[model samples]
Target: MKKVLMGMAIASSLATMMFVPNQAQAAVEANIGATSNYLWRGVSQSADSASVSGGIDYSDDSGFYAGTWVGSLGDGNGAETDFYLGFGGESGDFGYDVGYILYHYADLDDGDFGEVYFNGSYADFSFGVAYTVNSQVDDGSLFDTGDIYYSVGYGFEVAKEYSVGLTYGYYDFDAGSDSDYGHLQVDISKGDFTFSVSRADEDSGDDDTKFVVSWGTTF
Candidate 1:
């Protein structure tokens, strides 16, 4: 997906990205991006700082796709790499996607995880959910099967080439209800550049409202 459009919606939670391959033919694509701050599921992955990222994706007309993305973790020289595969298609204005993803953090202990996601969309509105299915944490019980996230989003063009998007997301953890959190995001974009602002609920451990400028392109 294009970064600007992807940012305007909630598709999945994997290094700030989710993919649904719906191309009509087999294709290979590459993309690169830079963000003032890398936020994943409403949490700053770049410590409220800047980060650079890039990825390559492959898709087939049959709705099968796979991709890998990597980016600076904003924690010193640490980095995060992600791999995902999924199937997606549309009938008229409605579409659906199902996928699995894995996240790996280099030089970060206990930071690896795996999730499965489902998404459905109609027109400009979208809904999605992801469940944690694997973890590298030592306390696996607390980080286990009960972790899940839900999200909703809507996007529309405000002008010929300018657009606005609104998104809301919630997280639930098995550890405790107190650990749950939610966030809202707004995005405005034209072409390959985007401006965005988001805020996480106080329960998310970080209540700060974040603003970000980002540019991305694919070929």
Candidate 2:
């Protein structure tokens, strides 16, 4: 329980740049943003603690992109930073992404974990599958520890400056263990600033609910 809470806190401290647009033939973008909770694919990326994350991206029109991102996390294991390298492409309404997620700890007792993920999005719906290549799980013997997740989201315009959305995802892992999560989000934009609020829920034996709020700007 303490570890979970600490993860969330570290997630909130890491500011990260996501959703970079490639307008020019060869484009590069730098970004920095923070979120109250680090939720990735319906699972808490942070230890249920606040986390801040950020990174930069470079992309080309040939459908190749690469970037690195880092964040702080809370855990007795001492690994407080995470880094990832990924590539993604969009073909009309369909898109595909593949990346590596690496968890680096500072303590010796806790080892690092790395995973690979592939994701697809069509219109407002997205789905993905992930595999732990070098799972730093407590027990390294856990093999074939893969995860599947899917999400669907649509946005509604409210007034000229406000919009709301509903997003949901389902996660299933090895054995019969599975979890479902949903989010209700609202976005308000004025000029160069955008503010958002989201509520996330996880349905499982240890169900957890969280509320997140964030403010960001785009160049």
Model 1: residue 154 alpha-carbon error in angstroms: 0.5
Q: How far in Å is the alpha carbon of 112 misplaced in model 2?
A: 3.0
- The most accurate candidate by TM-score is 1
lDDT of each: 0.72, 0.49
lDDT of 1: 0.72
Off by over 4 Å in 2: 1-23, 41-49, 74-80, 107-111, 140-144, 175-208
**Candidate 1 lDDT score at position 99:** 90
Deviation of model 1 at 148, angstroms: 0.3
Per-model C-alpha RMSD: 4.7, 5.1
